[model samples]
Target: MQGRKVAAVVAAVGALAFVVLAVLLVPWDPVPGGPLHPPPASSVFTTDQIDRAEDFAGLQRIWSWSSLAVSLAVACVLGFSRLGAAFVDRVRGPWWWRAVVAVLALTLAGRVATLPFAVLLRRRVLAYGLSHQEWGAYAVDLAKGVAVEVVGTSIGIVVLVGVARRWPRAWPAVAGVLVAGLVMLGSFVYPLLVEPLFNDFESLPDGPLRTQVLALADEEGVHVDDVLVTDASRRTTTLNAYVSGYGSSRRVVVYDNLLDGGSSVDDREVLSVVAHELGHARHDDVLIGSLLGAAGALMGVGLLGLVLGRRGSGPADPRTVPRVLALVALASLLASPVQNGISRQIETRADVDALEATGDPEAFVELQRDLALTSLADPTPYAWSHFWFGSHPTTLQRIALARRFEE
Candidate 1:
């Protein structure tokens, strides 16, 4: 017993050290650039914008909290219920097929259960004029999302069951590696495969904006075969952009709303958006994110193995899958803060890169403000909420960062 206690202590210490190292290694400061004048506070937002922002922030908080609660409850139900095992037993198929069916049923059930919250959130988005997608279109998108989830989760469960059956003792480490590899592969393929289902993407026309985007990429040492413009205005009024995939698949995607004058995003704001995405490409943020995800998976699986080993049940045992799934869900929820912390750091660095690459802190500041207003983002989220759930820094923090860059 004393030996076990010592081992636990040592393990805890090691995990703490790893977390500290990760946080410390991340660059929290903006990149160096020439001195520039800071934009006036008044220029960031007007009185009317602030009032609108406050209202939107309150709505977002409500939606975020409710959605999280609903999701957690659903996860608990699926994970703790014997329904998964019963469903598997009722299905007449090979062991793999049985696992697949069980997973699909559970996944579908969870999706159905949480659909009300999804609808509620959508309603709020519509109310705020953030989304223009009709219910019909929304329903179609939701169906597609579920279909993708079913296929992906089914394959994953089958592979996991197979690994467990083949190597009960070694399954955790093996499965961890496999899961990590799949994550990387998924990131590599998502832009090509999954993204197209939601929106049509077309290459940006040869114009000043496109030329400036390509030039920014070159300056940032990021290769670009093309800049794709996504038709996001059909569903959203939010102005946004992103960098996805890697190598030949790597591309910067800008929202059509930003380019088509659906919002207040001007030419300079568009350039700022492109520059920020290019920063992601320049730093290979996708690869780094994949590696982080892989590490987290490895850790989670190892911990899962320890817990299951203590219970004297392996993944090969079909009866144990429900408990395993439950544990995984719990583990993921517990790890979210850490995961989000890493994300925020990466995003902040990308923001810094955007500022440096453009050497236009004023434009960056204006774009950040405009983005928040356009997306109806909360200017100042609750501290605990931001720490635990926020993937990007708060709008206020971003604005502050831009101001600091000017100094």
Candidate 2:
């Protein structure tokens, strides 16, 4: 018993070490002097625009929150109830196979339970002119998402149980390291293996825009393999661009919507967008994030082991998979604030990078306004909600920062 607790403590300490390393390594304050003071939302948006955005964001919040609640409930009910165990018991298979089946069954159940919420969100988006995806297309995307979850989660669960079965006494420490490795592996390959399952990509054709993008990457010292464009406009109307992967695999992706939709998005705006992503790449932000995630995964798995052993659940038992999943779901929810805080800081630094890289404060600020109006983002959300769920600076705050940077 003491040994199990010690294992958990060791993993926790390791995670703490990684956290400290991250703190020391990351440039948390990319902008010198102090935090930028954002102008009032009214300064940038009209009363009518604010009212409409508030209305839209408020309703969107309700749907999203309801979905999250129902999904958590589904996880807890299956995990705490005998239903999940009973389903596993009915299956005749080796322990490994049963473990895989148990994970899939519970994951599918949770997803199916939350499906209605998904439909509601989709309908709302369609009505709001945010999405034009057909019902069949939506279903296809949803199924693809489920398949990815099943495969990914199944592999991790199998590893967790396998190591536990082999080294019951020290499995917490072993599984912590193993799960952490999996986290890094997943993050690294996600851009390659999983991304294509959803969208098709084509290289940005030879043009002044593409040439300038390449030049910008060169200036930022970000090794972008290709400036590719995604068929994102087929589903949604949001303007976005991003960089994913690192090393030789790194590439910049811009949404066709951002390029072709509104006259508001000009070459400079697009450059500003890609520059933001390049900030992520140049700083190895994804690498940093993956490192942090790896540490978190290790910490979570150690805690899971401590809980499982304390409950006398067999480490390798298929019956315990649901409980394992439930705990993960809870841990994720509880970690949101801390995770989002870090993300917001990282995103802010990226914004700073975009400003410095482009030296186009006017373009950056206008692009932000366009993005906010396009997405119906609330310029100023509740303090508590922003702390908990906001992963990026509010649009108004971003505009203010660009203004400050220009000064």
Give each model a TM-score.
0.89, 0.97
lDDT of 1 by residue, 1-407 (tens): 33223323433443554465466555544434533343443456787787787787786678767876776776666666776666666788788777777777777777777777787778888998998888999899999998888787666667667887887656765676686677778788888999999999999999898888888888888888899999998999888999888866787899898998556778887898888888888878887776666656555655666666665645676656666767877777788898898888789888888888888888887788878888877666677988988899777667777878777
Candidate 1: what lDDT? Answer: 0.75
Residue 256 displacement (Å), model 2: 1.0
The candidate maximizing TM-score is: 2
Compare the candidates by lDDT and give the number of the best one: 2
Instruction: Record all residue pairs in model 2 with backbone atoms less than 3 Å apart, i.e. clashing.
Output: none
- For every model in order, what is the number of clashing pairs? 0, 0
Decoy 2 TM-score against native:
0.97
Predicted candidate 2 versus true structure: per-residue lDDT over 1-407, tens digit per residue: 86468567856766796688578756678666697888998899999999988988887888889988988998888888998888889999898899889888887888888888788888888888887888999899989988899999999999888987887777777788888888888877888999898999999989999999899989988777788899998888888988777666677799999989455799999999999998898888888888888888877877787777777734677788888898999999899998888888889999988999999999999999989888888888988989999989889889989989778
RMSD of each: 3.9, 1.5
